[model samples]
Target: MTLKLLVFIHLLLLIFMAVGCNAQHSPEDFDQVNLINSAGPYLGLVVPNSFELAPLLDPSTFIPSKNVSHIDLSGRRFHVGIIADQKVIVVMTGLAMTYGQGEDDELAWESNGDYTRDIGYIHFANYSTEESCDNLLNNVWFNPDEIFPKNGIPEVREHAFWVNVSETYYNLAEQLQNVTLESCINSTTCLPTTPKIVKVERGCSASILAANAAYKNLLHEKFNCTLIDMESAAVALVSLSMGKPFIIIRALSGLAFSNLASKNAVIALTKFFELLSDKPTNGIEMYDK
Candidate 1:
């Protein structure tokens, strides 16, 4: 199947599920609840920070609604617009995934990297090892690992397993296994291989960057994590608490302990949103088998 079909399938599942499993909230002390409730069944597209948000908000990708005004609740500013024809509310979580130094550092990449490792959509986040792992220079962060039921983790939860992407989305991600991703910064500064989409079984989120090759290997070997980041697992926990469906799309810019892969993030994101624009906004149509 083509990437366009894959993109359509994803958006279809996202919106359909969003509409079907709409969660209602009681009015609380803050009037922000009322404003957000009136926003109507939007696909909440979240990013870690402005760097990731810029691509989605770009004129070529996200088209703002002229009729509706933007909403500011709490400190977060939400932009309601049409992206790839689907109505979405875009917001930045103001989080960071990158830490430690690049190049010249002990943890810097020392060899040629796999440029073909971009674009991974996760099925599960392994936050189970948070308490066991060391913190970022002794700073304490919220432990999402402890919020689960005491009887150990189950295969699925009643409210969709913390915005679980579902087995269907996992299978759909397999279609992009051959999709080409950006691998070069410039002619002379290109990676050795082209990037491709991956189906991540488990991704771990913590405060520290996986800058050490040994540390990266430890997480992979011990936890069976395909990738590590700073925020997805926490987001998963929050979504689970709120009883929502969600998915995380991770664009790999560089490999841990290898050559610093640069510019691939922008390249991968540009390609990603471009594919999103191919489908009709309403997304009522079904994909052919």
Candidate 2:
């Protein structure tokens, strides 16, 4: 879809924090030169892998017709379909980074984690300490520098970059913060409390998939980021560079190496789509949390 149309529909991009582990490669690895330019108008849904994709594919949510188009570009597959009466193009993101890697069956997703919220702003930083940031800039695998120049985005720097989520979309999310979400994975497994949306002051995005408590603490205490992610910053940068408004809704599956995180990313997304179907007025007032 064209960038303007993407913003028009309030393309609420749902990206889970857990997906950070799978994105270890660059998009150029797939040779997707015209991937975005040639696409049609549709809401774009980006998920990290199958675990997140499974919920959306349920017949209750996604409806596909015989006229569905399956376009294979490089190693990634794009599925065009309908969801909540909105035409959508759903694609599993991080494919290029994981193309050659074999299946990771051991990987699991949980919906009960801390800081499950709709993101308002993103702060990008190096995965390593400042002492190593320079080294990382020179040796990183998925450097944004190469892509930014072509898109007219500012060149990547060894320091951090900050960007804001679309105010329109953020306000919509703010309205949904109090909406209750499913807390049970099944009758036997359940969360102590249901998931709810909250506005984060900032979210830290780096290429590294962090599972260390010390690092997670640094992001919180030092950067003032309530959540950590790997993809949203890059997505935010590209969207801003094109002057397209976007919002990233994130659900925490777990906390840095802690197995206690819940699995509500899908549940959160389902609630979001249900709201989109209603086409709510953007006039809803929101408060900072």
Identify the leading candidate in terms of lDDT: 2
lDDT of 1 by residue, 77-169 (tens): 767676655566666664333222345332222232311124432222243347765433453333224444324366443332223543433
Candidate 2 backbone clash number: 9
lDDT of 1: 0.47
Which regions of candidate 2 deviate over 4 angstroms? Answer: 1-39, 95-160, 255-263, 277-289
Looking at candidate 2, the ten consecutive residues that score lowest on lDDT are 1-10
Query: In every candidate, how many clashes are there?
Result: 5, 9
Given candidate 2, what's the lDDT at residue 250? Answer: 68
Q: What is the TM-score of each predicted model, taking all chains together?
A: 0.57, 0.60
Candidate 1 lDDT trough over 10 residues, lowest sum: 1-10
